[model samples]
Target: MGEDYNPEKEDVYLMYYDVNNLYGWAMAQYLPYGGFEWADAKDYLTLPEDSEYGYILEVDLEYPESLHDSHKDLPLCPSTPAHRARNSAKTPDHAEDQT
Candidate 1:
């Protein structure tokens, strides 16, 4: 969906904001506990992002390189954490002590 997005362009500007409490902030939010019921997708689609209800959606996504340029500054979707083995290839962050 990179209609006119181009990260390689000279005039493009980027900014990074450090969200110190992003997960912590969301953890502190108010969430519904019960009374969840199935609703039609069409009806649920009409709800705004900041709607007063919580939802769990099953969506299929198509992420392409062109779309990366459009969303390079920020992600278009939230990342679902991947499960990996602790003994897998290690970057410095995960490397064992060299001592």
Candidate 2:
């Protein structure tokens, strides 16, 4: 029988493929500050790829093979502090300081 291949159910595992000998590395977007976000490779390679803008990956840090936190060396998603600041608007603290 031929090898079973299902794209939908299949998760493209990219690790140690020697694209650059960078172990557990992945492509992600880097925010202005200092953080990273992970993107699905399969989703990336889909028919309608998101190539409009140059979405880069965090190749410098190590990425875990599985989604689970098994390796400390591997890097995770960026923290939420930066995210909060982006969407939030605050008034001047001088008003509160006066009272």
Candidate 3:
């Protein structure tokens, strides 16, 4: 098939790349109500607390991909729920339960 390019796969990789770029400046926010948001680059860099949103988590591109594997046993992408849960669990509120 002459290197069948999958649009789905391409979209995923593009998304991962964008999120990583956002981390380069702004930060990823983990909301308490099971939602996520991103803070402005300036706000994130300055560590502002008046964002009127969730907590900001510093982004580390070197870290493992937030969504690595799939639930279907194949080396595919993860669902929205799975990714959200994984990221949410990384929050301080969730980690505090460990102690």
Candidate 4:
């Protein structure tokens, strides 16, 4: 594993190994935001080869906030008074004279 792993550019791998045998291993990649892309036991090695199994995990991840401002350009919902009130609060009133 390298420290240079960048979440934006690559996926992180989580490996499972049989501690007794040391040869038996399985791997999976972590999905963005949450969860993982798991590999089948047959894809790497059989789990029954050793009853004791352990995990070796490596992660490189990123979480970025949305750049779009939700408050900007919200369409007024005519059905809801609360929504109208919220939208009106955000609007600048020209009738109020600025000091």
Candidate 5:
């Protein structure tokens, strides 16, 4: 049987965009996950305050289990409670009806 794919085991990344240049770029890392603290992305704390420069995107790079297991020491970004609660409140069912 073929091997299973695990998204959580994949590498995570933070992509930065250049609005004026109309392009984007990503950092290079050997591990599947970016070697950064979770707090940097949680709570929108690390997000750029300015809109002109563009924004950051969190991406999960799906890779083979062998590769994922090789770099298990890499740090994984954390989804904070506050971020989860905020997203949960935005669900269509939870959204307020506009009449």
Candidate 6:
């Protein structure tokens, strides 16, 4: 805010969603149990639609430099907890904020 900034003279827009029991609905989905096994490429490639064999897929990706100029302040996606943040000296999400 500048020296001439005024709260009453300005319009502050607050956008929000009114979702009830959203977390509870998501938690009601089927969850994995027991031990997990390393599946081969073929097993995952021809996985059945109803199967939760490869429910999650983590990709080692690089954010494009072309878009960095506009989206630098925002995190595009949730990063893996084990790997370090791209081009940062800070540790992964397990400890502290990458910022």
Instruction: Give the Cα error of residue 16 in candidate 3, in Å.
Output: 43
What is the overall TM-score of model 6 with all chains considered together?
0.42
Q: What tens-digit string does per-residue lDDT give for candidate 4 at 1-99?
A: 589867677454465644673334333332245344564444234435343443333445443335223322433321346778776663245446443
Write out the backbone clash pairs for model 2.
24-63, 27-57, 28-57
As for candidate 4, its clashing pairs are none
List, in order, the clash count of every candidate structure. 0, 3, 0, 0, 1, 0
Query: What are the models' TM-scores?
Result: 0.42, 0.18, 0.18, 0.15, 0.22, 0.42
lDDT of 4 at 44: 32
| C-alpha RMSD by candidate, in order | 9.0, 16.4, 14.2, 23.5, 18.7, 9.2
- Cα lDDT of model 3 by residue, 12-79, tens digit: 43222224476645556543675666655655455555556546455534435554553223445334
The C-alpha stretches of model 1 lying farther than 4 A from their native spots are 1-14, 18-30, 37-40, 48-53, 85-99
Summing lDDT over every window of 10 consecutive residues in candidate 6, give the lowest-scoring window: 82-91
Task: Give the Cα-based TM-score of candidate 1 against the true structure.
Answer: 0.42
The alpha-carbon lDDT assigned to residue 72 of candidate 1 equals: 72
- What lDDT, from 0 to 1, does candidate 6 have? 0.64
The TM-score between candidate 2 and the true structure equals 0.18
Which residues of candidate 5, in runs, are more than 4 Å off? 1-54, 58-60, 75-99
- Candidate 2: residue 40 Cα off by (Å): 17
Candidate 4 yields a Cα-based lDDT of: 0.44
Expressed as tens digits, the lDDT of each residue in 47-89 for candidate 1 is 7867788688778888887887667778888574565454455
- As a TM-score, model 5 comes out at 0.22
Task: Kindly provide the TM-score of model 3 when superposed on the true structure, using C-alpha atoms.
Answer: 0.18
For candidate 6, lDDT tens digit of each residue in 1-99? 789878778355554767799889879876778677765445456777667654565557888878864654555864556555454544567456635
